[model samples]
Target chain A: MSRDALQESLSAVMDNEADELELRRVLNAFDDAETRDTWSRYQVARAVMHKDLLIPRLDIAAAVSAALADEAVPAKAARGPWRSLGRLAVAASVTVAVLAGVRLYNQDEIAGAELAQQTQQPVMAGPQVKGPAVLAGYKESADTTGPMANGVLQGQSGWQDQRLPGYLRQHAQESALKGTESALPYARAASLENR
Target chain B: MRAIPLLTLLLSGWFALPAHADEAQDWLTRLGRAEQQQSFQGTFVYERNGSFSTHDIWHRVQDGQVRERLLQLDGSAQEVVRLDGRTQCVSGTLVAGLGNSRDAPSRALDPQKLNQFYELAVIGKSRVAGRNAVIVSITPRDQYRYGFELHLDRETALPLKSLLLNDQGQLLERFQFTRLNTSVVPDDRELQPSNDCTPIAVANSKAPEVQSTETWHMEWLPPGFQLTNTSARKDTQTKATVDSLMYEDGLARFSVFLEPISDASVTETRTQLGPTVAVSRRLNTVDGEMMVTVVGEIPIGTAERIALSVRGEKKPAAQP
Candidate 1:
């Protein structure tokens, strides 16, 4: 592809407005060093124009590819003392990747934690209405106890709601059938049907 | 003189601690033997968060054989009759899917064995069912099981009230006798099952018809729990052969159910019903897609872990 046309296609791809031909052209030319440099420059320019905070000199795809390629080379090495060193290198790279992933995940979790706090505001406020005594007591507030007490998964209408009762009944009945504790198991099974 | 009395009191206090601990253990040992030796009739109440029911029990020991009958006082006449610790018959809702495969008889409460899992202590004394009681607390050593606060009749050594408590010290369930009488032996008329009671079909020990292929196994289990029973039968509704395995750690019990769900797009889910938690995970197997459901009176997190650890037997493809 001509340099000008390739540049145009890269811009279009970045905008997410590329036609099928333009997308294919950009992807095909992505492997070229000059093309990748141009793509990075375009991304930086776009981020600057949009006034968005951008991470400098960080190409996650390239780093991942390097890590993967580094991993593959060690596997093909001849079995010798050097092979063990190669395995160690692969392990080190894997550790780095996992650490990077965990760091990124933690960042996402921190962001999500703020949103979760907002959603939980109402739940926290509900128990306050009961009284200060309820708050001071160890008794967990209603709808905030165990997953079963809150009926967390029961309302979703589907196979789970349909099949779970049967599964629970079968388990309770089957346990009752065999266990020495006749009354407890039997009571558990009967309670399932009571619902 | 004051110093001498104080010194003696301190010495006696130090010695009393171990003696009290032994008394609690002895009460548990007596509880194990009480069922076999004592004859009693009592009315008890079983209570949970959403459930409360009263039951009447008639336990008779004669000729070295123990026959016990329990009848629900309110609602359905749920009755169970057991002779020598084996269920002879059950009424109302109890009759469903009751197999007669004689389970290994109930293990006697071994204080030594129980001490390994529970921290047994005689906390104090109280009154239960109008009788003096010794409050023996059996706190679990691990989070895998719940703790029990058992109140034993001081005179008879029979459990008068039992409370199941979670790790948070919150009561999950309570079994307490409202009234109890160990003085008189219950006769056969009182021990007989009501008309609604259905006789359980005793399976021929020689051959069990529906033997499980035992194709599935759990990669992990909570410590102390062991597989107690396994069965395979065609599900009445789904028409799929369902394999089930039951596990117990003496105090806690859980059941794992494996059912083929190749045609259904059922996603993995978890639900808790009162004390029982059910965790369902969809697993792909060599044969097809299977739904592994773990249900038990266990912690929901433990149940979820158990659900994820179910492994189906790997079979080599015959075509190759």
Candidate 2:
């Protein structure tokens, strides 16, 4: 009869609807072999109801207890000249990292500034000729025009290529025709035509 | 002790910046008035990546009436003539359904309203088309729109040059006059459209009458954008029904196009040309799969987000 009461407490605890007394009863009976087996069977049955794969032997609680017992407290080391050397190494690495980060940030800013200046120049340069020295020389001869990285839209050249240009022209033309900013939209439409 | 003087100096500098901002706002106000008042004829070059073209514009204001004519100087003479913001005639290609009568009154540029979305400031001065110009930078407050650096004529406040810039300050497109003459008003002969220019029939256009209501709606849009227009039409090529919705955020505009997919093989795509970004995404609705294409002069990320935010409007329960 007591075993039956303990099993009832186990069921309540598993459902997370247990009172403090029932929870304590299940925890106390957890050391008993038959109760543990009953708990495992209940878990498997719940897993099956939930359509989750039931691992036959997953005693996480016992494994955690064993691990906790085997774990050792870390030993504290004495501070010495070697510790100071380690501190120095850390400081040097941090300084290097900060300096590198600053350098990278500065380079990005400078490159951006240079690009802005190039874009503003009155003379018309070939689209391929703009940008860095590397990209300027890299002819876009690839047949596959995948999504673009820098411009309005870049993607694979299949359905998009077939329909996108028409959609763009229509949108640009309609916007130019509809919106009050007459010249801007017209310019946008005309630009699309140029492409 | 040192902090007191530093704080005072910083406070004064902060106070002085607003004065310059007021000056920029004043210039913008002048620009609005300039378009209605000034008479000018000029040839300007519009340039973007992979495209460059020159165009001539003749804007004349007489007897409180504004008339303008624009013609491509280089290419096959693409031309348009407008009388007071209404297109009278267009050459080369005629866009159906967009007649003069359908045009809602153009919104006047409000510096106050624009200030909410863009930080306007007079950066400096420059000379364009042999005229003294004040450079006004309209930097967008959000990523949804691009920034504009406008070179307004110092005397007339007319935009002599305009540059569209991306978030990185890289120029996407440039519109600047190489030659401008404001002394002489363009005569009626110059303002008149050529014989070949086709007149748009505003009376019997059936396209504007049909509107798509509640077919699709955006789940989320960038703050400040509003639906301006919506239309449903049959796709000429695919023969599929296409629904289009247009939205505007005072300065920027974008169009969302939804077309039912008969072929299930089409994949999502994105494309960019100059300042314009087009993002296409496949959306599964209660009916079937639809391809949503968003095209506009918006950032690619903004376009993509907008494309993803499009959702079909929910149907109400059928009454018994």
lDDT (CA) for every model shown? 0.70, 0.71
Stretches of model 2 off by over 4 angstroms after superposition = A1-158, B1-18, B202-214, B314-320
Model 1 spans with C-alpha error above 4 angstroms: A1-154, A177-183, A193-195, B1-21, B94-97, B100-102, B202-208, B211-214, B314-320
**What DockQ does model 1 achieve?**
0.11
Fnat per candidate, as a fraction, reads 0.26, 0.26
lDDT of 1 by residue, B199-300 (tens): 776322322345444477889998878887776766556667777788887777898988888657577877655567788888888777888899888877
Give the range of the ten consecutive residues with the poorest summed lDDT in model 1 chain A: A135-144
User: How far is B112's C-alpha from truth in model 2 (Å)?
Assistant: 0.8
TM-score (second chain) of model 1:
0.87
lDDT of 1 at A155: 49
Per-prediction CA RMSD (Å)? 16.6, 20.0
| Residue A18 local lDDT, model 1 | 100
